[model samples]
Structure formats: structure tokens, C-alpha cells
Target: MEIQLKLYGSSKILSEKETLDIQLPNNSDIKKLRDILTKIISEKYSRSDLENLPKTAAFFSEKDEVIDDSYKLSNKEYISIIPPIGGG
Candidate 1:
């Protein structure tokens, strides 16, 4: 299965495109996605600012609703990654 991750905020660092395609096994959940992201970062962008993104970011469905770590992902689904925001 593949997920089209629409990049937002700091997540944009993951790729040069507006969206990043992530391949996963069938029936994989958001938790698995996070694990995969961690590996990607460690392997490719170890010193980049995305190190904590997988653990702190929030995911949204095509309908723009929040989805948790246990949410099941379907093939070719368009999801959005919302990186955490900091404020004064």
C-alpha cells in the first residue's frame, strides 16, 4: 500500500514535492507509518529537523479530519501530515 502524504509545515523537509509517497504493507496503521518515517529520517535525513516529526505530528484524512495512530490506512490514500506548531 502507498500513502500520498501532503506535506505541511516542517514536513516539507521530507521531500522536494508538495506531497511525499510512502510505501507500506497492506493493513498498516498510522503507528507503522510513524515507524517507517523514523527509519526514513534516520537513514536519509539524520541531521535534518524532521527527527521528531513522526512522534509529534498529527495526521488528517482526505476529509480533513484528525486520525490517530491506530487508524488503518488504505492503498493510494491521500493523507495530510500536520507538524506540530510552536508559539510564544
Candidate 2:
């Protein structure tokens, strides 16, 4: 199954488009997604720059709420990745 990853903040560097398509096994959860993300950054992107993204980022469902690691994902679901924000 594949899901659309909607990017935000530093996560925007993951792709040129607003969203990226990620393929995962059936019934995968957010924890699996995090692992996949970590692999993607390490393989396709700069590991030093994004090595912490998977651990520090927050995942949001289409309903605009944060989803936990155990949250089950459905095929073709749209998930938003929001990287950590910092300001004074």
C-alpha cells in the first residue's frame, strides 16, 4: 500500500513537490512509517541534516491531528510530516 506524505517545515527538503508517495506493507503503523522515513533520509537525503527528523517530527492525519506511533495507516492515506519548530 502507498500513502501520501504531506511535508512541512524542514521536512520540505524531502521532496520538491508538496507531497511524497511512500510505499509500505499492509497494516503498517506510524512506528513503521518512522523507520521508513529514517531509512529514506539516510539513503536518499543528507543523513547529517535529517538524521533526527524521524525521531523529532510529528505525524498528522488528514483530519489535522497528531497521530501516535501505534496509529494504524490505511492505503492511500494522506499524512502530514511536521518537523520541530523553534523560535524566541
Candidate 3:
């Protein structure tokens, strides 16, 4: 199943890309998605960098409403992960 992913904030810096089209096994869960993303980010940034990223990660449905990360996503679903904004 193919899914749309959008990364923001420091996560974007780590990914070196704002968005991506990832294909995961059918019925993949949030945990699986997290693992996949972690690996992708780790490839660019150190594991410590990813781990230090704010915990403001979130998942939204097609309607743009906030949904639990564990919420099931369907094929072609669009997921946007907006990390917390930091300032001086």
C-alpha cells in the first residue's frame, strides 16, 4: 500500500525532504510506520538527532483532523507529521 507522508520542522531537516511517497505492507500500523521513518531519518541524521526531535508528532486524516498515531491508515492515505516549532 502506498501512503503520502509530510515531514515538518527538524524532522524535515533530518529527512532532507519535505514529503515522500512510501509503500508499506498492507494494514501497516503506526509503530511500523514509525520504525520505517526512523530508519529513513537515521540514514541522514544521527539516531540521537532523531531521538531528540520534539515529541510533537501528529497524524491527521484526510479531513485534516488530528488522529492518534495508532489510528489505522488506508492505502493512499495522506499523513502529515508536524513537529513542534521552536524559537529563541
lDDT of 1: 0.93
Regions of model 3 farther than 4 Å from truth: 14-17, 52-56, 86-88
Per-residue accuracy of model 2 over 48-81 as CA lDDT, tens digit each: 8789999999999999999999999999999999
Q: Give one digit per residue, the lDDT tens place, for model 3 in 16-75.
A: 577777778898876677777776666665667566443447665668787775777789
| TM per prediction | 0.93, 0.94, 0.71
Q: Per-residue error at 30 for model 3, in Å?
A: 2.0
Q: Provide the overall lDDT of each model, using Cα atoms, as 2-decimal numbers.
A: 0.93, 0.93, 0.71
Error of 3 at 78 (Å): 1.1
- Which is superior by lDDT, 1 or 3? 1
Give the poorly placed runs of model 1, Cα more than 4 Å off: 86-88
